[model samples]
Target: MNRFRYSSHNLYSLLSQPKSPLHPPTLPSQTLVSLDPSSIDFSNSNQFHTNSSCSSTIPSVSSTGSCPDSALASPFSIKFRSLHLYRGGYIDKGLLVNLYLVKHHCYGTSSSVNQCGFRNVGVNELRYFASHKQVRDILGMIRRKDNDLESKVRSMNVSLNLKMCSRFFEELNNQKRDALAVCDWIRYAHPSCRNDVHSMVIDNLGRLGNYDAMARVLSEFAKKKVRLVPLAFEFVSLSPLKEATVMKVVDVLKAVEEPTRGSGLCSLIKMFSAVGSFDMAELVMQLSERKATFYKIMVVEKCGKGDFEGAADLVEVMRKHGLKPEAKIYNYVLSTLCKHDKSAEAGALFEEMLASECAPDPITYEIFVCHSCKAGNFDLARKLLDRMNAQGIEPRVSMHGVILKGYFNLKRFEEAYEYVMACDRYICFPAICSTLARLYVKADNVIVAHNLLLELIDRGLRPDQSVYTNVFRRLIDTGRTALAEDLRSRLSSIGSKSTMGAG
Candidate 1:
């Protein structure tokens, strides 16, 4: 899951000096040659040629026969075995996994047992690591518009598949134009999957609320007379709708023939309702047949705007239309009632939801717990937390944080500490621990806060940088220069980015 950031300086480091225990015993003809991936000019086909004197140290490969055609067999072939890649003073799992593949490819089904009996890193384990690295490298090349990108990929024997391209596209920063460039390359490389790739672009644009870029893409598709993909509309269904964006969508839909255009209009209606444009959405919905869906979305929007009565009235309207409201619709109303101090009404509605066969979800309980904490009713919040556990619904960390904040507000530090400790060990405690440390610092108990922060670090929990910075600044002001510097170094080692530079 780790996306490696590559640089020329550390692209490939020399690990030629063999280490005992980690490295296998030397063979008669085997000599290790580290391939510095960054230094190789992948545009040169000759770069893949094997040196006659050199032989793979990897077991099962005979020292004879022309070395496996080092040139990329196809766009997807990767020379995983030829490179010794290392970063940050440790062997990456990618190298180990590729080495496993090399041995397997050499051994084939001749034997499940490794002939050389090397320690198995498990077959195909960390395979994605190597593939991700190669994909990222290609993405980087594309970003720089490197003319050698195609040659490099083919020369390095790296495989570019649709999945890898999609992942790299998702990881691209929220720059739509940059994503568009990548999308074009993907479309050219994978003509068969053009719609799927375009869907990704539209999803990214909608997720970022970049309607301008989305409009351009839609316009280009219309110009090309490409049929609008149904999936694109699905992605944009929850996006915030604007007049200009909707117009562009309408223009594109005019070209796409029936059925799909009909589906697209439905999604457009949902998009409008999602953004609280209920009146406009209702007008659009007149062209569609999904009355129930539109009503549900409106109820949620009404609750969001704190119009509890309006949301409740919409629920009655749904029932009149023979559409049963879901737990989510009731939950929104409950949340609004609680927010408006209508706790009695919320309680009644909760009972009604249960009676109507609408099972309460995690959010239903979360709403009550949050209200209880805000009302300073710790007893009720604690009971609600227990009920959530009894119902097999795990309370999120934010809920615990909320209760802890309540205790800290009442200056009940002992109870807060005990409560956190009593919670399951599996529950993440960094945020809770950070809140405690910050409280100590706020009370002018700098030494206690500093000590607590150190203990949390030893427990492998990272405190927020704000608390660390505060303690560091306090230490300096108190003339404890060495202590202040040590804290700063510790912060740097933890890789926490601080707002202020070390002073």
Candidate 2:
């Protein structure tokens, strides 16, 4: 009998039953003390926008262009007036809506729409609720009843549905609107006890990478004298943190007094590394030595900022501390050096990568190949390319395009055929295909560029307008305007204008 032991109590794991359909799994139970609505305040909320006109907040002056007599009106062409304006003026579209307006005026249906039956409603109904301006207006009307315009809205009070709260989060996060800005407009303006919206606001603040903002939100959660503020501490790992601010956080964290994780301490080291504050990083590193993440980030950031000397110093520090730098770590350093036009330094780093236990990735070898060709180090580039192939890391066509150009530039016409042969499809990316097309244009081989572009499109690689423009320009310049015109039609079908300056 097979003797492998497995826990049997949780049969639901085998069934893969969903935990929650309506919401994501809960975070650590938020212990935030509820503030009275009167205590909730933001002075910035009333600051009128300087760029806005008192008369109208509609961003653009209306287009006077009318449809020609011969043209039919577009089904999708809806008027773009500033929403909820009597004529054209910015006023509070408070968050309450009359149930009657939503029931009757929304769809010309007279039926009363009361409580949303399900918290997470049907998708078809959601799509309508999301797109239809009437629901948006209703939610907008539900904001602060204190606004003079919304005084009437207070008479017919309505709280936002959970679904609508989720929608607000969606829009704000998309715009990357400041968390406090969203709070001032929605939560503070129209207070709700919904944990979902509050948690979402805090989470979004965390993601946007402001340590102070995170700390402010978490302070309301509870001052802990034992465990670390897990959520508040995440943003500290993000680089470019001011030293003065970080020190303040460090002091506050000490006061809140938690058993600190080594990883958390390491994040401070990383922030120092990002800003090239090596002394600060070293101070933290002296407290602990196994932080591989801290070392890796320092090398990449130093190289990116063109402090090759600092990056080299970090590598030496890594070795001195017995921390083994990984392959991808070396890849990042190599990419940064090559980007900054330090090919010789990049080549030197490549040698170190090879000598060390870290295997050079395809990206490392390819970058060396591209710049080596540009620098006229043809032999070195070719040797590196052969080593890259030997490693059995699949050659990207983007990388190969560099070598192909090198061959063309060297007048190695005989070798060109061998380079253009089919490569492994299992690992090929659409980016390489785009690169190949662009390379053909540079070589004045318009026919190949045109055919390859069509092939890419046929294989479900959708090029953006910029890609279309690049190829179209090349084709037009090369007197392949007929072919360019054909591609233009395809581009136009996707709503990209190909004739703006194709000449």
Candidate 3:
């Protein structure tokens, strides 16, 4: 009989289970807080319960219906039941599972070992039950009413199954036109998700001209450990997202210790050009210690926009970075100087452009000619025109119009008329007629202006209200009241007929 008892004890030892699922061994009789039922406040409860069967520490039930050891009770079954109640729409879950997992992990509970699995199961169940199109529709409506709840659900799914989240991003990347989905997936996917959704978003957003979304994606990526490529920087830099937003992204990237030496500097230059924030662009160049061809282009563009000081500063920065200013750069600076009414400086820059090995293009000659005319340097304008002709670059009708307008502005109607006739000889259609009309009106020659108007009409060029008004006022001011009235009636009839046809 003693031998039989020893054998039975050995068999029992073999069948025995481990004490807990958690590592480092869990302590016995520990109280865990329940996050279910959603409305019962347990803040005042100091009760405790035991999990081990080794001890029989029964709690006293008070007359007020409070159990002494309520805190230590195994509330897992109650919480699971509460999830069912929530699914049935009979209770508020309110992220109770998330709260439980967080609290249990914090408190070193053995039950926290299965938190990830449990959350995954909960999400799967939620997705399964909510899969019916009608149910999904309803849930979408409900979610719209409570964005916080929706965010919590998304956060739970991410924390539970990062792989699944990554797959969602992969699917989004394959979509052709659904850029919105790509953007949303990149925004909410877990950091551990394998596919780089952020990069995909950056690429597509740039293509789609969705600058706002691109900036947001850059900001999100900036928070992660992933390395940003030069193209991503370029996308963000060229986007229409504001400087403050771009700066915020830059700050986040800087914190991540991203090296900005290569194409990063080019992106910064483009970004500054887009927003007209040259100082910040220069700061980035200084920090990056790299200069690119795009830097010169950006400076020229700023000069074209009449920002001469910015263009000059950019030139200085380029030289400091050991980059020689090209012909394009000089043209931009000169154009900018002319726009700012600095004619002498502009002339000096033009001379400098010619002296340098960098040859001027047709556009450079046009800028100089126009600026000289505007500055009352008609002689200089003529000189540039002659130089352009010698270089085998024939001036277009627009160039002739510019010179005629300058002569007209200087009250040299005869010279303006001569240029108008020259424009006609060059087969410049509308410019010749428009210039003659203006010159005739200015010289109080309404008959010639009327004839030019008729020629414009014969050429299928419909003059807008400004053109008609100028002609009519000229006729009336020159004492041809009857012709002015007749022209007014004709314009009104034409406008009404066009409106009716459109309708």
Best by TM-score: 2
What overall lDDT, based on C-alpha atoms, would model 1 receive against the true structure?
0.55
Writing each residue's lDDT as its tens digit, candidate 3 over 229-343 gives 4344444554566455456544543443333223334555665666777666666655544454767757766876766666666665666667777767777786676667665
Residue 168, candidate 3: how far off, in angstroms? 23
Cα lDDT, model 3, residue 104: 19
Q: lDDT of model 3 at residue 173? A: 36
lDDT of 3 at 462: 42
List runs of model 3 lying over 4 Å from the truth. 1-267, 270-293, 296-313, 316-328, 424-430, 438-446, 450-503
Compared with the true structure, the alpha-carbon lDDT of candidate 2 equals 0.48
lDDT tens readout by residue for model 2, 1-503 = 01112233221122122221122222122211111122212111121123333442212111222212231111111121101222323322221122222321121111111122212222222111223464465345433322332343233333344566666655555555545644533443233343445555654665565557756654554332112222333344443654544565555433332233343455566656666677766665554445678777677767778777677667767877788887777777767767777545555665666566777667767776666666555556556656666777776555766765665555443344334434424245344444544544445555655665666565555443344566788789878889999987754454432222101
* Candidate 2 TM-score over all chains jointly: 0.44
TM-score of each: 0.43, 0.44, 0.40
Worst 10 residues of 3 by lDDT: 27-36
| Model 2 collision count | 11
